[model samples]
Target: MSDSPRTILVVEDDNIVRMLIVDVLEELEYTVLEAADAAEALAVLNNADQTIDLMMTDLGLPDMNGKDLANRAREIRPDIPVLFASGYADSVDVPEGMHNIGKPFSIDQLRDKVKGILGN
Candidate 1:
């Protein structure tokens, strides 16, 4: 593992939900970048300077769905891990190499999910 902390990009349309996720991730000692919508999230993904270890986006975004955003993100960063957050996590059909977590997840769930995806 690298010495620097792993960074995660969080994309959610709901302000409160996004804030809560960011706070929880930060508390878990991961560097977090936040976006309110798909456009913002794409902007971050397009920036070559940004070192994002993983992306956790809400399935229901104001502009685009999480799956679409993840597709575009994969185009930009081919190997980046994508984690989808949804109220209907059990029903979500994430493709291979992608993951999903239910809404209202406990902090421990989020931490474990991220660690599992990042392999740390």
Candidate 2:
């Protein structure tokens, strides 16, 4: 990975899951931005000056669904890559070229997917 810190937006409703992802990304030396729902995610994206390198979002949310959030984020930041994490593997239809990490994923799996998306 490059020495420069990459910014990652994590939109997850589950507090534990969100924190786990934040911790992992932090350990990998990436700057992490967190959102509990789509609204917060959009707010963060709207206020961000630089491009967000990656986004890891849960498929289900209290507000808008993660897939919709990802779509909206893509509209504003087309270059940013998205990774959807969900237990409902068969339910959500992820965007083309986007990535998905099943709910019970291992740390290695998460790391590999993020690395692959960032082209590390």
Candidate 3:
């Protein structure tokens, strides 16, 4: 394994969900960074030196939606992958070719999706 940790930026407004995703990522041996909304996520993306291996964000945020956040994040880092985690999976207009994890997901599902995205 590399000395530098793989970073994942998780953007979710709910505290419990945020912590759960963080825990899962940490357990999988990736470094996890968090943001409560798109603005905060942008700040982290702007400041972090390590490449964000992937981003998992909720579609419903207090400010902008996750798709918009993903677009902005891509503008800053075009190659980074994004995953949408939302209860509104059937409703939200996600960007084409982006990945997603629906709400109320199990740990196994989350792990599988993360691994699939990271190609681990």
Candidate 4:
């Protein structure tokens, strides 16, 4: 609700994928925070000076799954939107209202998903 760019926390173990996501989001004028694991994402969420608008994380992480990360994030920021990115979408059953996009997603697809989630 503030007059600032919306922030998105991206968590992925794969460095290339993480970089791609961050680059795409940043190109779209979003404030992106990157983390390679759940612990790092949690640290960002817990200490962030600004509110994160959404969390777009890979489904499988090195330490924890995306669903668990989202649950933990909600505890810290109840209203934060979650967008799960996974190659195995059929395996992930997120709660209703949560957004998700499959792996190998194009930039436009990612952009649309993020915009929809943020109501842009």
What are the lDDT figures for the candidates, one per model? Answer: 0.94, 0.87, 0.88, 0.90
lDDT of 1 by residue, 16-120 (tens): 988999999999889999999999999999999999999999999999999999999999999999999999999999988999999889989998999999987
Rank by TM-score (best first): 1, 4, 2, 3
Pick out the ten consecutive residues of candidate 1 with the lowest summed lDDT.
1-10
Query: What is the alpha-carbon lDDT of model 4 when measured against the actual structure?
Result: 0.90
**Model 3, runs deviating above 4 Å:** 1-3, 91-93
Clashing pairs in 3: none
Q: Which portions of model 1 show Cα errors greater than 4 Å?
A: none
Backbone clashes in model 4, listed as residue pairs: none
Q: Tell how far residue 7 is off in model 4, in angstroms.
A: 0.6
Candidate with best TM-score: 1
Clashes of each: 0, 0, 0, 0
Q: For residues 1-120, write the lDDT of model 2, one tens digit per residue.
A: 557888899999899989999999899888899999999999988875755888888989899988888889888888778999999766667778688989888888989999999886
What's the CA RMSD of model 2 in angstroms? 1.7
lDDT of 3 by residue, 2-117 (tens): 76767889999999989999998899888898999999999988875757889999988899988888999898988879999988677766676578888989989999998898
Between candidates 1 and 2, name the one with more favorable lDDT: 1
Candidate 4 contains a number of clashing pairs equal to: 0
Model 2 stretches with alpha carbons more than 4 Å out: none
> Which of candidates 3 and 4 is the stronger one according to TM-score?
4
